[model samples]
Every structure is written in C-alpha cells, then in structure tokens.
Target: MNNFYKNYSGIILLLGGIILGSIAGLVFGKDVVALKPIGDIFLNLLFTAVIPLVFFSVASAIAGISKTNKLSRMMGIMVIVFLATVLISAFLTIMAVRLFPIHEQLQALKITEKIEDKPLADQLTQLFTTDEFYQLLSRRSMLAMIIFSVLIGFATLRAREKASGFVRFLNEGNEVFKHVFILIMKLGPIGLGAYFAYQVGVFGPQLFGAYAKSLGLYYGFGIFYFFALFSVYAFVAGGIRGFKRYWANNIIPSATAIGTCSSIANIPANLNAAKKIGVPDYITNVTIPLGATLHKDGSSISSIVKMAVVFALFGRDFNSADAILLALGMTVLVSIVEGGIPNGGYVGELLFISAYGFPPEALPPAMIIGTLVDPLATLLNSTGDTVAAMLVARFSEGKNWMDVKEAA
Candidate 1:
C-alpha cells in the first residue's frame, strides 16, 4: 500500500485537486475565481523552469550520443522512420479532430486575449526562428528554441572528444531541472484545485467541456492504430511473413508498454521483441534505445488532439489549413523536446500555451489530457520502436533480409 501510494501519489493528488475544485465550484459558484491566484503560482513556477528544462534535456539527450556507434546507414533510416511515423500520427489525429470537433460552442467560449492574426509568412518566420538569441529564452519561441537546441547538440557532436565537459554540464543541468519539476508538482494539488475552481465557476460547463469527447476519440484511435497500423508497418517491412513475425513476438513488448506506461521502461522488452522478430542486431541496437528518447508516434497523436482541444477551448478553428499546418510543425518540434524530459509533457504542454499565446490558464487542461491519454500513447510509443527497427533493417539490408538472416 505504501509503495503503491508513493508511486501514484502525483496522479492521485492531481485528480483529487480537480475533483475537489469542481465540488467547490458547484457549491460556491462564481466566487471560485478568487482562488485563481493560488493556481497562478503553480503555472508561474512551471513556466519559469520549463524553458531551461527543455534546453538542457533536449541538448543532453542528443549530446549523449556516442559517435563511436558506427551504424550510420541504420541511423539514417531510423530518422526517416521516426519522422514519417510522427507525421502520419499528427495528420491522423488532426483528421480525427476535424471530422468530430471537440467542442460545439466556440463563439461563446473564446478567450478575450487571442494570438495576433499575422500573415502566414510572418507566422512561419516567428515559428521557426528568432532575430535575437535572447528571444529563444521565451516559451513563445519554443519551436525556435528546439531548433536551436538541436543545432547546439549537433555542434557538440561535431566537437566530439573536445565537448565532453559541456555535455556533462548539460546532463547535470537536466538533473537539476528534473528535481525542480518534482518540487513544483508537490504543489500541484493546491494549484490545480484552485485553478479548476476558477475554471468551473467562471466558465460553467466549459470546464468539463469536450474533454470527454476528446479522450474518447483518442482511446478509440489508439486501439485501432495499435493493432491495424502496426501490422501494416510490419507487413511493409518484411511482407506477409514479417507481419506474422511481428504479431507473434509483439505480446511481451505490448504488455510491458501497457503496464509500465513509460517508454524508457519498455526498452529492454522492445529490444528483446525485435531480436525475436528477426531485426538485424545492429538496427535493434541503435533504434530501440534511441527510439525510446527520440521517436514518438503516440506523443505526436496526443499533441495534435491536445492542441485542438486548446484551440476549441479558446474559440479558434483548428480545422483551418493554416492552423493545422502550424500545429503539425509544432507537433514535430514537441515530439523532439517532449521525449527527453522527466515529467516531459509539461514542456510540451507549455510550448502550446506559449507558442499560441494561450493564457497560462490553458495549461491544466492540456496536462490533464496528457495524463489521460498517456497509457495508450505509451503503448504506441514503445511498440513503435521495435516496428521501426524492423523497417530500418528492411531498408539497410534488402527485400529478403529476414529470409537471408534465417538462411544463415
């Protein structure tokens, strides 16, 4: 009981906070907004720590890569696999949201402060880069900062033996920020509770609005994608036999992913499953571990849904081509920064808040969405790594690579 409580305490507190806040709102009505300042304290702390957290976590994850791992062809193919799967996920989620809008009463719910309607060209420029280095420090520049972090990581990679100290600093910084997040979350019950009260009181039914539909859509898609899409990926990699091999050996990895709900935890299971399913050792060696940190088809799906719900809550049209294009681009960047942080979804959630100029209040709902969808999302995230290894092997070897391996 103590062990279980210790492990699940954060999630328990968070949900308890929301439940208590909802009750308070029901009892007290509009006066609940008075409690909002307390919630704002939590948001402020998260926003302050989040930028540095992302910088160090992302850079450190990439810099930790040892150049001695000479699986260049496999690595290149792995990049293609990661990006392609995430793109597909983002689009599919976008389509799902488009076909079944998360919220119906957009005009009534739109927030007073909105992101300025910039020309597409200007929006693109701002989204991708900033004029000054200091600008990257802001959450509004999260996408730009992510790009910058990736560049710094690659530069460190280029420096090789000379960059060891800098890499160590990044790792230490990441550890520091991780603990900071822990301390901040210690305050989550009070903060999230107070905020939920304000939302329920001020917005009425809007606090509970569309979250049910959104979560339902996510779970449905996750299940369908898990069985149907994975089989397709395996079939593509190795033909009918490849499909058979994947499903045959996938049970343990899938079970571990579902039970643990941590991508990193599922790595050994994925590596073992990949080996059994006939992935070349070199491909599995490079892809599964790295994929735990760098690739995230499931996170990609959740991101778009979370963004769409935020848009709906703020009274924006997420289905617009421009809105969706920007969302997909941000989804890619979020997938990069999101994978490497501890309690990492906070960075990705805040990225949406900052990038879209959503008020700080927008965060809790996104965090809630992340928490709700995490299990199935992790299932995809971990399993996808093994399937990706199979794809990399297919490309790196030949059409009959699995057959060739078996013959030997």
Candidate 2:
C-alpha cells in the first residue's frame, strides 16, 4: 500500500484536484477561477529554477564525458546513430502531417498575432548571444546558453587537469540544483492539479475537443513509428528470435518511461534494461546517459506535428517544398537543444515560434496536445535510448553483440 501510494500519489492528487476543480467550475462558474493563483504560484516556482537547471544540467552532462579515445569513438558512433534516427523520425513526422492534414475548423477561433519580424541576417545572429551575463539575466536565448555550456564542457574535457577544479564545481552545482529540482517535482500533484483544474474549468470539454485530431494523430503515429522502426532495427541486428528477446527485455524501461515521463529520470531503468538485453557496461554507461540528454526522437515527432498543425491553423503554407525541408532540418536542430526545454514541451513551443514563426496565439492548443501525449513521447525516448545503445554496441563492436546475451 505504501509503495503504491508512493508511486501513484501524484496521479491521485492531480485527479482529485481536477475532479473537485471541475465541480467547482460547474457549480460556481467563473468564481472557480479564484483557484488559478494556486497553480500560478506552483508554475512560477518551477520556472524559477528553469534557467539554472538547464544551464548546469547541460554543462555537467558534457563535463562528465571523460577524455578517453575509445569513448570518443563511442560518442561519434552514438551521434551518427542518433542523427540517423532523428532525420528519419523528422521526415516521417513531416510526411504524416502532410498526409493527414488537420481540417480548417479551427479557423473560426481568432488567435493572437504577436510575432516580430526580423531580417534573415539578424535572425541568424540572434541564435548566438553576444553577452553571456546579459543573456542569462534576460533568459532570452536558451540556445546560446546551451551552446556556451557545451563549449565549457568540451574545454574541461580537453584541459582535464587545468580545469579540473572548475569542472568539479560545475558538477557540484548541478547536483545541488538537481536535488532542488526533485523537491520541486514533488509538488507536481498540486501544480498540475491546479493548472488542469483551471484549464478544464475555464475551457470545459471544448478545450480537449479543439485538439482531438492533433492529439490523436500524434499518438497514433508515434506508436506505429516506435513499433515499426524499433522492430526493424531489432530484426536487422538479431533476427526474429533476437527481436522477441530484445522486446521482452526492454519492457521495464518502456514502462518506467511512461510512468516518469522523463528520459533522464529513466536512466537507471534504461541501464538495467540495457544490461538485460546484453549491452556492454561501457556502451550503456556512456551511450545511454548521453542519449537521454541528446536523443529526442519522440519530442521531434510531436514537435513536427504541433508545428504542422499550428502552421495550417495560422494560414501558413506548411506543405510547400521549402517549408517541409525547413521543418525537417529545424526538427533536428531544435532537438539538439531539447534538453533545455521545460516539461509539457513548453520550450519546444518556443522553438516553433522562433524557427517557423508560428503565432503565439496558436501555442496554447499545441501545448495542450504536447502535454497530453508526453508519456508516449517519453516512452519512445526511453525505449529508443536502450535500442540506440544496442545499435551502438552492435555497430561499434560488431554483430557478435548478442553472443554475450545470457540464455533465456
């Protein structure tokens, strides 16, 4: 009972809050909006930590990589695999959007237009911030911060001894914030509950009705892609019997991912699943960790879907050849910085705004769809990590990967 509560308390609280909040909404109508402040406070608390959390997490992730030659080869192969999968995933997403286009029903709802147009050169320059401190203070450019953190991490790797102290400090800083972040996550029940209550209370069922097609399409496509692509990869690597064995071993990581909705949080489970599936310790240790931070096939797919939907709603020509190509490339590039994205795909929404110039008004429904399907995305992400590790092991170490597999 204790363990069950421990595991499910957040879901329980969220459901309770929503139920009660909805009742209040129905009974009291707009008066129920008084509860909005509770959710706002919680969101503010989480947002407070976003900048530092992203900065330290990215920096520490890079700094943790050792300056070893073999590991370098492993990282290179891992990246190649990661990009290969991302490119394929992105293309699939674009194609899916083009095929099952969302209808023009949402055109009735007027959306806010709050985008600032800039010259191509100026837009390009904005990606890299000029003043680090100013950027940090303003919280304006997450890409710039991510870029800087990665550089610092690489520098520490190259100047091992000279920068050892600084690296240690960064590691310590990350740990401290990580603990704080965990504590903040403990407030999920109250935060998400209040937020959902306010949302459902105000918008009613029509809110969900608005995004039904987009959500349905994303989830449906995600499942198909995961099974289809993962099955193919497993079959290629280990044949029929091996494919069955691989999926059998990967059940735990897949479940952990859906439960936690976080790839980074599923590291231990992924590592365990990797071991069960016979990924070497060396490969799992480096590749799984890095993959969690970098690989975001699930997020990429959802982002593309959201972008396509938003573009269509705003009367943009999303199906044009140039638009499709830009969307594909942007998915890959935005995915690289996905680590900095806040939960519920908020940062991803910003990426759409910046990359494709989608209107800010269209963000709410897109976010709603992203939040609804996050579990599916995380499931793909977590399971994909383990699969990627297997691929990395097979590619880096040759086809004898499963020879070391323990017999069933």
Which candidate's TM-score is highest? 1
List, residue by residue over 46-157, the lDDT tens digit for candidate 2.
5566567667767877777777786878888888888988888889887787687753444533444555545545655665555656665334465566678788788787
lDDT of 1 at 296: 84
The C-alpha stretches of model 1 lying farther than 4 A from their native spots are 1-7, 106-112, 340-343
Per-residue lDDT tens digits for candidate 1, residues 157-271, read 8897798899889889988987888798889889988988887777786556567878988998888888888889999999999999999998998887766667888898999
Q: In model 2, which regions exceed 4 Å deviation?
A: 1-5, 11-48, 108-113, 117-122, 129-133, 179-205, 240-242, 259-265, 308-367, 400-408
The lDDT values for all models are 0.81, 0.70
Estimate the TM-score for candidate 1.
Answer: 0.94
Question: lDDT of candidate 2?
Answer: 0.70
Best by lDDT, which number? Answer: 1
Range of the 10 consecutive residues with the lowest summed lDDT in candidate 1:
103-112
